[model samples]
Every structure is written in C-alpha cells, then in structure tokens.
Target: MRTSSGAGELLVELHRDNGVPLHQQLESAIRTRIRAGLLRPETVMPSTRALAQDLGLSRGVIVEAYQQLVAEGYLISRGGGYTLVADIAVVSPTAAAKPGAGPPRIDFRYSRPDVSQFPRAAWLRSVRRVLNETPNRSLAYLDGRGTIELRTALSDYLNRVRGTAARPENMMICNGFAQGSRLILQVLAAQGHTRLAVEDPSDNDLREVAAAAGLETVGIPVLNSGIDVDALERSGADVVLVTAAHQFPTGAVTSADTRAALVAWAGQGNRLVIEDDYDAEYRYDREPVGAMQGLAPDRVAYAGTASKTLAPGLRLGWLILPSWLVEPMSQAKLMDDRGSPVLDQLAFADFVAHGEFDRHLRRMRPRYRELRDTLVERLAARVPELEPVGVSAGLHVLTWLPADLSEEALREAALARGLGVYGLKPYWVSGDGPAGLVFGYGSLSRQEVVEGIDLLAEVVAALRS
Candidate 1:
C-alpha cells in the first residue's frame, strides 16, 4: 500500500463495522461525496496506491472499488497513469444498443430512470393485456409507424403534458431518440441538406453519430439562454438539433423568447429543427416546459423517449416530424430497423392507454424533485466555493469548481476517496472557465444523495488544504 508522496494524507471513511460490505460501503461513500458537489467532473483520481495507504486498506481492495466504478461508467482511464471522473453523459445515438442484465448502478452521469422504483407489476399487467387482447398475427410487420393506439394516446398526452402538437397521424413511432435522430439525418441529407447546426456544448456522441451518417455538423455557440441564432445563421447549416427542455449540462430552459426566435427561423427559412425533448417530464419547480415542436409542427421535429421516464432498456422512443420530412424520414425508418420491436411497442401502448404510465410518472416525479432538493442543500453547505447550475429542473446539476483547485488535483483526491464527478470540458466545443461537475439525482435515493454530497465536500477540503 505505497502512497503517492504528499497525496497519502487524503482521508477516506471506511466503516468495516455495520452490516454493509466494504466495497458497497466504499461505493456509497463515493456516490455521496459526488452528489454533494465536492469533486468536480473531469478531476483526476489518485492512484490505488495512495487510496489504499490513506484508507488503511489493502491496495487490492482499492483497486477493485475503482474497477467497479469504471465498469459502471462513472470513472474513465486516462493515458499515462491515472483514473478520472469521465463525462458519463457522452451518448452516441449511433452506438448499437447492448443489453444490460439488471438494475443499473447509481451512474449520476446520464439522465436515467430509477430502476429500484420502476412499476414492474403494472408493466407486466399491461404486457399481459396487450398479449391477450391483440391479434397474434398482427405482431408481424404491421405498422412501420408505431401502434395506432399508442400514437393516439401519445397525441393527447404529449399535448397535455409537453405541449407537443397535432393529429396522431403526424407522429411516427420509431425506436429511441438515437434511431429517430439517425432517420431524420437521412431525410435531411436525402433532401440535399448536408449540413446541420448543432449546439456547441451538446452531446458529442450525438454529433459524431450525425457525422457518421454523412451529414457535416457545424457547431453553433450556445449561450446561457439558448443557441446563438446569429452564429447559427452564419454557420449556413440547414438542419439543427437542440436539447431544448433543459439544456443538457447547463440546464437552461430555452427561454420563451428564444423559442419564438427558433420558430421564426424554421418557419421563414425552411430550416429543419430537430428538437430532442430530453427531459420534458420531471419538473419540480413548476409546470414542465412545453416542447418546441408544438410551436411550429410544420418545421420542428419533436423527439421524446421513455428512457428517462421509463428506462432506456425498453428501447422505446418517438419522433413527430413535420409534414415535409415525414414521408422521407418514415421511408428511411422503414429501411432501418423497420420500426422498433412490436412486443415492446404494444406493451408501451397498453401502459399508456390504461393510464398506468401516467400514474408511474406522477409517483416518481416528486421523488426525483425531492432528491434534487437534497443535493442542492447539501452541496451549498459543504463547498461554499462550488456554485451549482440547473437546480430548477432535470436529473443532474452542474457545479462550477473553484479555479484555484486544479481539476486534476481534485479528481485525484476524489478517486482516492472513491468519489465520482463529471467535468464540463467534455460538454464544451472550446472554452475554459472553472471545471463543471454533473451530479445526477435520479438514480440515487435521498439518503445516497446526502452521503454522496458530504463525501464530496470532504474531498474538496483535502485537495485545497
């Protein structure tokens, strides 16, 4: 258990007592510190040597703990000799879906669902109803679009809850957001629009996915309010993708004025607006923000998913394209997966039609809000220098760490203590202020939230002192 010079002094509270296993306890402690907003994202973690020495444990134990987090996507490997709190939110819509066996670990990186609380019984019940009620032969390549029943239900629900527009015919049910996005790219490219204007700080993986599909993405500067319209226009890209509901890391809801500006641009210029309504549900402060698609259905393409609301494993998402893009995008989708799995689509339709889905959301939205509140209060108490962005809505909160505390040093300290935090640089095109760390409360229980944030504060103290 050799230590890293002066870094050996960093402290980690390892409770061998109490019934919990050391590995889980360590993981819990790390999670607590991260949520409390002490460890900024992208901060490098200490070597296992330093962690084992400081915690008075075998290096093997520290190594195993670190490996667990890395497997869970909370920690990333850097080149020379270090581990880091990797940006967990880098999602590529292009990546093929891989199967996960069971519940996801508390990843605090992506906007995910609470696995422990998912209404399995209700979903099963819906599955049973759909299985028995629907024709057996209907399951084979019936609608390239989503089930008519589901589309009808979504038409009313999305309009009521998210302010999405139009007749059920306007909505084309596809796979998840990634699949849907790919189809849209194909449609725009087919129409001879090869360039897309994307948010500078938007998902890197998503941009890369578009690029893979033969569309050149032009980066558009995103201000605290919304995308820089002037910069976007100058980019000369005819297509655009926006995570409007709660801007990814920054969590700024597209202002009403900005929404209007986007609407005007798409309306007058014939530009296509691909609206990734990221987390439109889960609003604690007030009414959930409305969708940009509703503002100009003819120009805006509305995409929503059950990934955040239900779970990503369901592989269920929807896209409502404008009239012009509909035929082309739908044609592209037919050639893609030919449409998502009929079984899952039918099950989801039953879930929504029977009102079981809404009930689930109603129950979980408040729980998520409470978790968010706990994270904010705890972070403020622990690290006064760290300021949080996007506390009002969304699953994660971004913390701006003090510039004096090197992100590298803080990350090392947090890793020594088994902490996880995502740095903001990954979200930027090109800019440097202080580091931005993302804290996701959706997957964590209220108790985990408290403990995670507290540990983070302790790590911050060790780094600076």
Candidate 2:
C-alpha cells in the first residue's frame, strides 16, 4: 500500500507483476475514492512528483494518471496549481442502492413523463435561437415576473388554448408547480389568510407546502363531479387550491355548476382559488376542459407547468395571478432567488412562440393516451377485481382494489417481485382510505406496461391463495 500525504491524500495498492499498467491502477484508485466520496470535491491533491516518490513509480506515470483523471472529469487541474477533485463528484451506487439489492424496480409512481421522448432537436433549436437573438442586456437580472417575451407568448397561448385571461404583466415565472404553490401560499399567509382548503386525498406534497408557508390546511371531500363546494364553504377556508380540469387520484372533472359555485364562493369574501392545471392537455375521450380561471380571473390564481407537457427537469412554471397579487407575488418572487433562469425563460418563450411547444404536445398526447389505455385494458382483463377509477385523462389511473385484499400486503408483494406501485392511503390527510393503487404509465413502454400488469396479476393470485 502506497499513500501520498497532502491537503488530500491518495491511497493506492499496486500489483508489481499485474498486466495492468501502474498509471492505469493509480487512475482507477483515485476515481474510486472520488466516486465513493472519500476524496471530497475541491480537495487539493499531492504533487505528481511527491506521489511518484511515495509510490516508487516514475514521475511520468503519476503525470499520466493525473492527466487521465482530469480528462475524465474526476479531477481538475489549473496552470501551476495542485490538482483537485472535481466539484461534481457524487456517491453513485452507494447512494442509489443497498449493499445487496435486487434488480431495479419497475416504477409506477404517478406524474412522471417519458423523458426519452423529449424534443431534443427542437429544444436545441430554441436555445440556439435565444442565444443568437437575445440582447446581452436582457440576460442580466430580469424582472421577477419573468421575461416579457415568455409572458407575452404564454399570455397568447393560455388565452387561445386554455381559455385563460392571462396578461404579460400579471404573470410570474417560477421554478415549477411546487415553488409556484409555495409563493402563492406565502402571499396568502402574509395577507392574513389562515386556512387553505385542499381536496381530500390530494397531492400530499402540496399540502406540506401549505404547512411550510404558515397556513393551516383543511381537507374538503372530492366527489365524483369535483370538490364538494358545500363542504369547502363549511370548512371556513379563506383560500382554496383545486385541480378543476382533471382532479388528481380521481380524474373527476369539475362540473359547470361546481365551477360556478367555486367562483361564487370566492366572490363572496376575501377569498382566492389556486388552480393547478398540471396536466390538462392529454384528454383522449373528448376535447380537454377549459381552465376555471377563465370564468373568474379576478378571483383565481392560475398555475401551469412545463413538467408534464415538456419535461419536469426544465423546472419551468408560470403563475397567472389576480391583479391584487401581481405586486406582492412579484416581490416575493424577487426575494426568492431573484426569479428563475433567464435563459430557460427566453428559450421557452421562443419554443412557445414558434409553435414548437404546441407541436410537442400534439405529438405526446396520443402516446400518453395509448399508455393509459393499455394499462386500463390490462388491469380490467388480468385483474378484474381491481376496478380502474380515473382513466379519461392524465398520465396515471387510480385502481380500487377489492375489499378482501390489503393495499399494504399487495404493495409489499409487488415490491418483492420488483414492481413499484403506490397506494392512495398516503395521500389521504387522515391516513385512512379505501384500498387503491395509482399506476403511472407515462414513463413505461407498451410492452413494459403489459409485463407490469401481468406480474401484478400473479401477485394478486398468490396473495389470494
């Protein structure tokens, strides 16, 4: 074992007669230590001469190993400066897996899109166009309300497609739906709003955001048509968040009557509605429903994201605020990271303006619809006992299990078989709900969807036995 001491130490054990070259062995040892997080980012390494002297190897071998590590991004070198580990070093297999884990689980967790289908060429074109056309001054710290170009483009797109009354001046670009919701809740809390009414069994992550923003959350039941307005009114919440076009975990579109009642409920007091139109573009059975914000723009704060339609990693979302919120929300946004990335905002603006965004959705809608259809059909055929609940829109469907089966037991069995399935119990605020599972099919292929369902059926049969 040969070790070199410095601000960062290198430990290498070399085989004198092994076929591998000394340089190769030294490079491998350093790479492994960096990946295992033993050699942290920015830690300076010993001089090549010092390391060579310590290991009884030629200086040329140490230099070759250091150069190789630098080329591979495992190390960084500057002129006349000691080599240092790259700042991007991360623990890999250790962070992602246990010591003796089984094969990768087939993840069916909902709300993820097929990232492989991302429009790379189109996105590259948009980014290139932005870089070419955008003025240098425009790239500086921008308005917290986002770039005027994107807001203008989004204003037109939302108005034309979603029936929103969005204006360039009234919208703020955010990191994503999660951050958008947090900003809104923070504004509401600052405005003396105490209670936020959310749909029961809604996205638990959003509920946690509401709590973090200093607003107490109250759950209102979600009926087949939509959120129970009567219960919302009775809950005495000053603000409400809803997925009116297509509710999550249930796929219930809010009826016209309920939309009216909700707007009316907001009109009666100092109330507001936060509409998370997360995935309203993929309705296959009929034309998608228009946004609820159109009916009552003054009372509704609408939020839309590029996560489901384009890709989540983009972290791009926009909020169409009520006129009263425009100033406060923009201020809050300014205080929260000085707004999202200007380059992404500009590229997205160009993406939407050139109709690339529309074309992308046009291409993806049917693909997602097919995935949803296959999952529903397979569930109905192989495990008829599990009734598919919401299948009309969105990337996932919720299936209610038979009363005799246990959600926990079935989920554990599915995991043992390397299948990842989520249950509705965790989404409920009370943590008590009917037995059901949410199957997200957007990220899986047609054959994978079939195989997943087949495996699930086997698990069900075995559990019954």
Candidate 3:
C-alpha cells in the first residue's frame, strides 16, 4: 500500500546510510507516506534540484527516483518544471488500477464494443461445458501458446472469416494487444532493432511504452490512400506497425496494391511488419477485408483482441506467429507471463467449438451495421462539411472537421456542452495535418449519437462564425 507519491509540506530528513540506494530508499519512504493517507494525490512535488539541494544528494538520483515512479504509473509529469502525484487515492494498490466510473455517454473513446449483445447465455453455457469436460492436463500449466481447441477453432475462424491463412500451431493466446505489442517489441529489441515507423496519426500514450524499450517512433503521414509509401521510404524506419484491416482514427483500409508493395518492401529490406488487425470483424458495407498478415506471414506479425469483438473487460486476445519468429515470440511471451487464465481460455475454446462464437458474431453484425450507418448519416446531416473516413470495417468513425473550425476551440465547446470527443492532433508526432474526432458508436444509443453530434455541430458552427 506504500506508494512514493506525495509533496511533503515538512522538511523530511533522508537516511543515506541504509544498504538500499539513497534515492530508492527515499522513493519507498514517500510511497509508505502516501499509502498511510498522509500525502494526497495530485500534490505537487518539489523540483529535482530543490529536493537534491535539501538532501545533499545529486539531482540525477532524485530524477531517477521520480522517473521510476512515473514508469510505474505512480506519478505524472506535467512538464514546464512540475511533477504531481497521480490521480486517485486508494487504501490498497496493485498493478491493475481501478477502472474509471460507470460507462460514459457520447463516449467516442476507442476500444469499445456493443455490450448489450455480448452473448451472455452462450458464454455461460461454454464455461459450464468446459468445467465438465476439462481433464487433469487442462487444469495444469500447459502450453503458454494456448490450448489446441481455441487454436484450431481460431485457425478456421480466421481463415474463413478474417481471411487469415493460419495453422493451429501458428496461433498463441495472450492477455490482449498491449501484451502482444510488448512481446513483439521485446523480440525486436533483442535483435538490435530500435527505430520503428507507425501511422502518423496514431495512439498517443503507447509511443512511450515503445520508447522505454529504446525504440524511436518515425512518423509516416496517413493519407486517404492508406500510408504514404513514399513518405515511409523517406522516413527509413527499421520496422513498421500498421493497422491494415481498417486503420485506426482514419478507417482507411490498406489498398490491395499497397499491401503487395508493403510486403515486397519488407521482403527486400528484411524489415519487420506489425499488423494490428483491430476491429476487422465489424464492417458494415460488405464482407470483412482480408488480413495483411496472410500476404506474407513470415514478414507480418498479426495481433487481434476480443476487446472490440466481445468487450474490453475480456482481456483475451491471440497472436498468430510465423514459423521463424514463433519460437522467439513464445520465449518472450513466457518471460513476460506464464500464460493467460486457463479457465477463460477453455471457456472461449468451448464457445468457439460449439459454433456459439460464429452465431454471436452474426447476431451482432446487423446491430453494429445499423449503428454505423446511423452515426455516419447523422454526422453528414449535422456537419455537412465534415467527411467520415472510408471503409467502415471498425467500431468507430473518424470524421474530418473542416480547417475553418480549429480542433482546439471545438473540443472546448463540445466539453462545455457535456459531450466527450477527442482530437486527432495528439496522435500526430510529425507535426502533420488537420484535426478530427474519432467517434465511437458502440456503447451509445441512436438518440445519444444524434444529440451528441448535434452538440458537436453547434460547436463547429460557433467556431466557423
């Protein structure tokens, strides 16, 4: 319960005589103070220089202590010479921080799914069946690479549904994409590969996770034509992470020609390709698009999760590894964690084997299609100038707002109206392009969509005038 995150009003003395490093000891002492409820969350910490001067220690020592806490999600740095205790105070602490309050409205945030139709009965039935049939080996710590049932089912599911040509041995289950990413990065770092390129307009906070492992993000502009291949060539990244099925924030599918070109480029340069097959199953217009990982499994690393498909609460996902990288990835995965929960894995496998999985997907498809169409239509009518991103094969729509209305003003205006929307500016590290909103319709109702967007439209109109 002791967390080293607080700004003390009293001049605390440091004990440098302990066997533990002075800074680490100091960090632990502060953490104890925090858990005891003596220090408050969001309390500002003294500058590293000031703390160092007071303790008669080097500034690097205090800075290192602060950085370690920050990496562990205990403290937050607001820059401009300020560090503060992280948000929320709790009696007990663990790695899993409690989730934010009950669901959100107009929650255009990503990684969402239609929870109303999450196949509750089907899942419970599967769990019951698994409990009945699971043997002694199933209960023990078997292969971290997942059970044969889920892998075989996934092999068929991916090939038949998601256009993934994977064999049973090629797939392994993990907690989710976040773990999968770290595993892949660990392998790449082990191979001395560091500089990597990703979509310019990409997720903001994750870049730091890569950076911590000594990987630098080389940005590539995301055009309506998928990634700008020319820009990618110019950037000269050692590896590339792309969302080919339906690109996040832009929803642009990697065109077939571009897919071939990317494969060829990777083969020629022997570079790694990280394919995030996110939200590939929720397309509305037509059948789901083919996964890029199938084009050259040897070069492409495929990652998918049940977060969007089932629900974010289900921390279950699978990665299909190529023949060459499979062993290394498995080793890295083992190093990270022994494996996912056997109970959930067995239950999911049972669900897939019984055809309940496919039935659930079929049932949810129409509802998602209707919701996607509703959101797109409402966006068009309310904000005529804003264009929704193409190839609707995902959970959310990325609508481009006109340059006349700045994202900064519009976000402020929308929040004032009790509506939530995030701007695309934070995603772009290369200083490229206009801002837009990533609108998620998964957890919202038809009425809420119309009303929230109407609020956004009003904000735009005000900014334009």
Candidate 4:
C-alpha cells in the first residue's frame, strides 16, 4: 500500500486475497507499529479519506479500522475527528523482562541512607533563607566550579571532619559521585593517561566509567588491609581509583603503611590517585580514619557525596582537585551540564554553615550503628555459618558464606521467599571469587533486619538439606 502524504506519512499494508479483511489488516499493522515504538505516542494519524485514497481501499474500511483502534484505547479520537496515538506505556521488544516488577519484601540492597531521617524542617529553613538573601544575579549561570559559598563551606567542613586539605578554589560541585568520577576520568584520558588500576573486588561501575573514558582498566588484588600496592606498581597504571577510607563490598580500611606506600608509588612516577571517600560519616567503633588525601593533597583527587550521608535523591557531591588539575576539570565541568543546580548548592552551604548538617549526622550515626549491630548479631545467632567481613563502618556488612554454598542458588532461594539479597560475585572484575553476600542495613529497621536474617537462616538450612 502507498503511504499517505497527510499525518506525517501514514504507511500501512493490507491483505485482500489472503482472506484477511483490509480493515483487520490495517488495525493489526497500526497496533504493531505502536507497540514496537515505530509510531510514537501522540503521533497524529491520517484522516480516513486520505489514507483510503492512498491505499486504494474503500473509505468504509479505513473508518472501520480507525473506530476499532479508538475503541480498543490504542488511538484517541479528538475534536474535529482527528485521531492520535494513545500515550500508554510501551513495552520494548528487546527488554528481558516486563517493568513494574515489585521489589522483594525484605530488601538488603545497599548504598542508600535512611531517608525517613532526613532533616526536613532544617533543610526547608536553609532553602527559604537562601531564596530571601540570594541576589538575582546569583541565579544566573555560575562558574563551572559551582557556587563560591558552597565551595568555601565544604572546604572548611572537609578539612575539619575528614582531615582533608581542600581549598574553596580547587573544588567542583557535581550532581553526585557518578558525575564527578566521569569528569575526572575524562580529564585523565585527555591528558594521555591510558591505564587505570582499580581494586579487584571494588564497585563494577568504576571499570565501566574508565572504559567509557577510553582508558584500560587493570584489577589489582585487594588484601585484608587494602589494595595490593605491590601489584599496583607492577601493573604499570598511571592512575588508580580507590575507596581507601572504607573499601566497598569488602569493607577493609587501608592500613597506614599501605597508604604511605601508595603515596610513594604515585610520587615515583607522578601518578595520581582518585579517592572515593563515600560513607565516611558513620563510624561506630571509634573516630574515623583521616583521609589519605590529607597526606598527599597534590597527588590525590578526593570525591565525597551526599548519597550516603544525607539522601541519594539529593544528587549532591563535591570533588577536591589538586591545584594543577583544577583548570582542566573546571572546563570539563562547564561542558558537562553547565554546573550543578545552584539553589541546592546554596542551601547545602547554609546547612553546613549553620551546623545543621553536623547535628543531622550526629542523630544518624548512633541509629545506623544500632542497625549494623543488630544485623551482625542476628546473623551470628541464626546463621553462624556465614561470617561477617569488614569493619564496623559504612552502611553495609560483607558476609562470607560457607565454602560449600552456592551464592547464586542462595540468592535465588532467598528471592523466592520474598527477600532480596545481593551477591558479591558481580563486583569482581574476573567474576571468580568466594561465596559472599552484602547486607545493607541502612534503610532497614531493627525488626526488619531481625526478620530478614531469620528468613535467610531458613533459606540456608533448606539449601543444605
């Protein structure tokens, strides 16, 4: 059938001798196009007369097909008899599974804070204060380094709290760690740095980002203390990305000697270190360790985010660059989204300057500590076969399962019982490791943790039997 010139070129095929009616063929074709996303939502359809003339079909057939589609909710009939595609959800043909699948009842997913504890009243006050005091010019396009008020506030806060040597002029406020890491990797790649070394069992996102930036990634083994520096030196990588303060998925803090050796390694070849200091706010046992960036400010680029401290919804993060790399990174930031939202940055600045941020953290630290304790205690009492790894810091506890147990089987069994648990295998670059699971207690209550662990014990016993 010929395409109609009207309504953005409506094309349809009809079968007459094949025994299927012309109207039925038209309706099925249109429905298939809409379902396949070839016809977008709200797309106008050709009038019956025009389509019929183009296809050499009777007007009655076109009218019948249009009416049937409208009755089936695939098309919307509007004023003046115009038909438009309905704005219904489109299921992609390539999708592995359908969307809207509900999450498990008891989820132990990590990297999220207790959003219910967000200081709504305090944050509102800060935003309202910023709106009243900020000048009209402050709302316009700002420097890619972000608002000066926030940089100054963060410079002071990071220094005092994390013992970082950050300066207001050398920091860039980003959407979150996701953006900050990308910006840094892009800059490094542009500067002719080719190889990036990452922790063997670290977050897989790092490897993906490095590859996106056109750099080769090498996985360096992580010892109990931290990343294996000796292996890192032999890898010939010019830069390394590490979560030194608290390693992710396996929660091991870098020892002081290893930190020094890492700095020395960078110094020998003028290498750089990208430190992801996420979730350093909550330390249950004692005072948190000072940041490695503090030791070698010139060699380390430090990144911190509000995802773990405040809420992931905030999408707020900051990067403290070495003086030499500031200009390039600032230019990259300008090209990347023209800097983060200004009003949110100003509000966070006010939050920090007024000590509201500290007060909020003070209230959350103990609460998270209690949840971590409960998770560890219940797991120990019920499923003593699973051993808890990592220190008493951050939002998650990495647990090593019994050597005989299969991580994938346990995860599937737990999911079948309406409980969600994450396995540690996917985090490895090689995907060959021991059977382990990560237990995130951030968003869970004390009772949820107890119940989840008890259910996990049942699953483990059944698997063994």
Query: For candidate 2, lDDT tens digit of each residue in 1-465?
Result: 123246235678999798999899999988988888888787878998888888899999999999999999998886775688887747676576656756536878888899999999999999999999989998788878999999999999999999999999999999998889998899899999999999887889978888888989888899998999999999999999999988988888999999999999999979999999999988888666899999999999999999999889999999999999999998899998898999999999999999999999999988998888898899889999888876888898988878888888988999899898888898787577787898998999999899999999999999999
lDDT at position 453, candidate 4: 95
Q: Tell me the TM-score of each prediction against the true structure.
A: 0.75, 0.83, 0.76, 0.80
Q: Superposing all C-alpha atoms, what RMSD in Å does each candidate have to the true structure?
A: 18.2, 7.3, 13.3, 7.2
lDDT of each: 0.76, 0.89, 0.79, 0.90
**Candidate 4: Cα lDDT at 30:** 91
Clashes of each: 17, 0, 2, 0
Enumerate residue pairs that collide in model 3.
Answer: 3-31, 4-31
Task: Name the best candidate (by TM-score).
Answer: 2
lDDT of 4 by residue, 1-465 (tens): 123237438777676799988899999999998888777778778998888888898899989999999999898888986788887767786687666758899999988689999999999999999999999998999889999999999999999999999999999999999999999999999999999999989899878899999999998999988999999999999999988888997988999999999999988866899999998888888568999999999999999999998999999999999998999999999999998999999999999999999999999998998999998899889998788888469999998877778888988999999899999998887678777999888999999999999999999999889
lDDT of 1: 0.76
Please report the TM-score between candidate 1 and the true structure.
Answer: 0.75
- Give the winner by lDDT: 1 or 2: 2
- Model 4 error, position 53 (Å): 35
| Alpha-carbon runs more than 4 Å astray in model 3 | 1-105
> In model 4, how large is the Cα lDDT of residue 285?
80
